[model samples]
Target: MLRGIYISATGLKAGLKQLDTVANNIANINTVGYRADITVNSGFEEKILNYAGKEVGKLEYGVNPDINYLDLSSGKYVPTGRNLDFALVGNGFFVVETPAGLRYTRAGDFQVNRDGYLCLPNGSRVLGEKGPIKIDNEELYVEKDGRIYNKERSRYIDRLRVVEPVDPVALEKVGGNFFVTAANNVRPGNALVLQGYLEQSNVDPNREYPALLESLRYLQSNARGLKVQDELLSKAVNDLGKVR
Candidate 1:
């Protein structure tokens, strides 16, 4: 009886965790460079089973919660017709200088900062191959090779710093459409920068939102099983133990 209760409790927890992940995906559906997370329900360890007091054998156990994986697929590109706005065509992320150090992101909505440096909307300086990109002239154009050009000055400015981690899953999310990766995992990527465009979030509400209904049903079933277990326990302890 107690084992049944434990299994039901694990199921309830797993359902709740799945629901939370789905909710997070829905919330970030509109966020740029956003990646949805998936919950992996790992099964429990092997357990010994006995029936009729005869050693039956080990049986498959139930599932528990906690494992999650990030979906690193890129989203559709949106053309904004702005030179500073950029989008990556392949697997890569743009580096930025944050107060906490260097962070990686796929969001390319950018503008020139007051100090003549190319920066994101929040003012974090965008990194180039040399360092923080400095764009003093308004007339700028980007080539397919990711090299920035100054049409007015008729010279090459700088190449955008695009890097990819050895394993994108190892990157940590630090809020505001950014991810931080280990310095060692940073490597040159094969992605081409598409000027005048931005990448949207890869979340698909049509498919992901339906998971909520399934999770809710699972949770309700587990709760019902747990209640039945509790009632059985009460009957066994109080009624069956009576001296009548």
Candidate 2:
């Protein structure tokens, strides 16, 4: 019965974590270039005690909650008609220079800073093929393949640095649309860049809401199980010791 209580408790915890992930996904539904995270869970391995080669008992069914993996898929693209707006239509990430170092993101809403350098809303300089791109105050024109041209200067400034990591699982979200990856296996991406457009969040409400409701139901069931287990334990300690 104690073991049953522990199992139910673990189940409750897993359900809550899953629920939180679903809620976060819904919350970022409108964010630009946002990807929803998925909660992964693993089951506890049964522990069997052996008494001099004879098995005594086996433990079962307690779930082990695991990490959240980013969904890495592309989102819908909305045309902004802004010269600096960009969107990636395939697998890739735009590199940005943060204070911590280079971070990757899919959000392409950019602006030319006072210094005439292309930067994101948070002021992170957008990295180009040669490094941080320097521009002379001019009208910006970017081709589908990421080549940037300064209309006023009549010169090609640089190429936008869109890279693909070896594996998406190695990337971790530190907030906003940025992702940090430990793997150094990054290469130039093949995705086409759409200028005058921005990528929207990838969350789908119809799917996430149903999943959240299902997790809530599972939590409620586990709560009922906990209540039943407590009642049985109470009977075992108190009623079982009573004399008629």
Candidate 3:
């Protein structure tokens, strides 16, 4: 009875975790450059049950969430026709200087701060080869290779510092569509930059809705199993052991 209760509890926990993951994906469906998380579960090894020093049967403990990985697949490119907007065509992240230190992101919706520096919507300064890109003028052109040139003056400004992680799986999400990792984990990236585009979120509602329903069903099933085990335990301890 106790073993059954333990198994059901584990199943409930795993189901809740899966539900949360799917819900988050659905919530971020409209976010720019959002990457969906995928959860994987692994079952505990079956143990042989013994009674009076003799093998009886094998008992299985329920599964648990093993790990979560980002869906690295690229999202669709959206054209905004704004010069400051940028998007990567391949693997890479745009480097930005945040208050918490340097962070990386795929979001390319950028604006120029009052300090004449190009920055993300959250005010994180966008980094270039020389540091924060100072865009004193709006008439600038960005090349596919990330080079920025002053159109009116016809002078070179700097190249955007696009980078890729040495171990992408080691990167952690820090919210607001940013990712953080050790400085040594990054390397120069080869992704092409589009000057007037943004990447849409990679979440697919069609898949997430079905996953959410399935997780809810699993949770409800586990809850019922747990209640059944508890009632059986109560009956065994109270009614069955009564001295009538």
Candidate 4:
């Protein structure tokens, strides 16, 4: 009875974790450059039930949630018609300078800061090959190769710092559409920079809605199982233990 209860509890925990992940994905469906997370569950270790030194059966514990990984799939390109907006075509991430440190992101919804530096919505300065990009005027032109040129001044500015991490799976998400990684990164060979566009979130509502329903059903089933186990345990302790 106790083992059954433990199994039910584990199931409940796993279900809740799955629900949280799914809910987060749904919430970020409209976020720019957002990547959906995929969750995987694995069964716990199986133990052999022995009776008088003879194996009777094998008992497996409930499921456990494995590490969640980013989808890494490219999102659809959205044309914003804004010069500050940028999007990547092939691969790589735009580097940004945050107070914590340097971070990588695919979001290119940039704006000029009060200090004449190009920055993200959160004010994180966009890094260029030279350093933080300074936009003195509004006539910014970005080539497909990520070179920034001022059309009015007819002068070439710094190139955008786009990098692809050695191991993208090792990258961890920081808040505000940024990712941090310890792996070495290199310039991508085929990534194209498109001005006046942004990358939409990779999360698809059609897929996420069904996944949400499935997660809810799993959670409800686990809750019912937990309740049943609790009731059985109560009956065993109270009614069954009563003096006849």
Candidate 5:
């Protein structure tokens, strides 16, 4: 009876974790450059089985109930009319300078800062091959090759630094639509940049929202199952105590 209760409780807890991941995906569905997370389940086998004081025996264990977190996949890109808005046409990341240090992002939404510096909406300076590309005038041009040019001077300012980490999953997503890579990951040597476009979130809200709802329902059902098991256990314990 106690074992049954433990198993049901584990199920309920795992269901809740699945629901949490689904809810997070739904919440970020509309976020620019957001990647949706995937969850996987793993099973564990019983170490030993003691059946009603009989000899301990080994039985083929079924899939153990556990949730494994998968990496977020790349999302699709959408076009925006803004000139500074950018996106990656292929596999790569744009470098940005934040207070914490340099970071990467698929979000190309950018604007010229007060100091005539091209930067993300959050004021993180966009990095170029030479360094942060500073625009002195409104007539600025960025090429697919990551070159920054000025119309007034007709000169190339710098090439944007587009680094590709060896393992994308090794990067950490910081707030403001940027990613920080692990210490060992190599810095991307070259990355193509697209101007006048923005990468949209990969999450399909229409699909994820409903799935999240279903997970919620599953969690509730499991909770009810656990409660029922708990009640039965309580009654059994009470009855056993009363037996003289």
Candidate 6:
């Protein structure tokens, strides 16, 4: 009876965690270049103690389990023909300058602020080889290689700094579609810019919605088990008390 209670408790915890992930995904359904997270579960390993060349003590599932792992997969690329928009054809990240320093993102929805400086939607300055790419004149163009040039000046000013980390898990997600690196280090990669295309959110609602429902069902089943256990315990206690 005790073991049954414990197993149900673990299931409930896991179900809740999975539900959280699903909720987060749904919340970001329309988020540009948003990637949904998936939870991976692993069962507890049993250990058996041996005494005098024979098994004496047996181990069972742990009282608590820790889950840590979020797989990063590329989301689908959507086309939005906006001059300031861009997207990674392959694996890469666009670098941005935040108050917390340098960060990265897959969102290419960029725009020029009032000061003629290119920036992300949240107003974070987009980093380039020559710092933030600022165009004095309104006339400007971004090359496929991420080079920002002026047709009037006939000069190449700066190049967007795109990077890809060896271990993507090292990156952390910040608000406003920004990602911060663990050590603030960036890996070398292509920084191609598309003048008239925006990247789409990578989350698949069809898949995530079903997963969310499944998690809810699992939680419900666990709750039922817990109720059953409570009733059984109550019955046992009542019988013991009727010792007259």
Candidate number of the best TM-score: 3
Which candidate leads in lDDT?
3
Candidate 2 lDDT over residue span 1-244, tens digit each: 9998988998899899999999999999988899999898777542232223555454456775689988887788999998888999899999999998889999999888889888999999999999987775677888889999976647888999999888777888998678888757677898899999999999988889999999899899989999999999998999879999
Q: Tell me the tens digit of each residue's lDDT in model 5 across 84-202.
A: 78877766788889899988877777788989888888899988878888876476677888877875648888888887778765776666767787756956555567777787888
Quote the lDDT for 213 in model 4.
Answer: 91
152-229 in candidate 4: lDDT tens per residue?
648889999998877878888877878998846545535899999999999988888898899889888888888998
All models: lDDT?
0.84, 0.87, 0.89, 0.85, 0.72, 0.75
TM of each candidate vs. truth = 0.87, 0.88, 0.91, 0.90, 0.82, 0.84
- Candidate 3 on 1-244: residue-level lDDT in tens? 8989989999998898899899999999988888899988777642232223455454457777767789989999999999899999889999999889999999999999998999998899999999999988566799999999987648999999999989989889889889999989999999999988999999988889999999999999999999999999998999887888
Clashing pairs in model 6?
75-202
Pairs of residues clashing in candidate 4: none
Global fold similarity of model 6 (TM-score): 0.84
lDDT of 6 at 189: 72
| Lowest-sum lDDT 10-residue window in model 5 | 58-67
Give lDDT: candidate 2, residue 146.
95
Clashing residue pairs for model 3: none
- Full-model lDDT, candidate 2: 0.87
- Residue pairs that clash (backbone atoms under 3 angstroms), model 2: none
What residue runs in model 2 are displaced by over 4 Å at the alpha carbon? 43-58
Off by over 4 Å in 6: 45-71, 136-139, 151-153
| lDDT of the structure predicted as candidate 1 | 0.84
Alpha-carbon RMSD of each model: 4.2, 3.4, 4.1, 3.9, 4.7, 3.9
Superposition error at 110 for model 6 (Å): 0.7
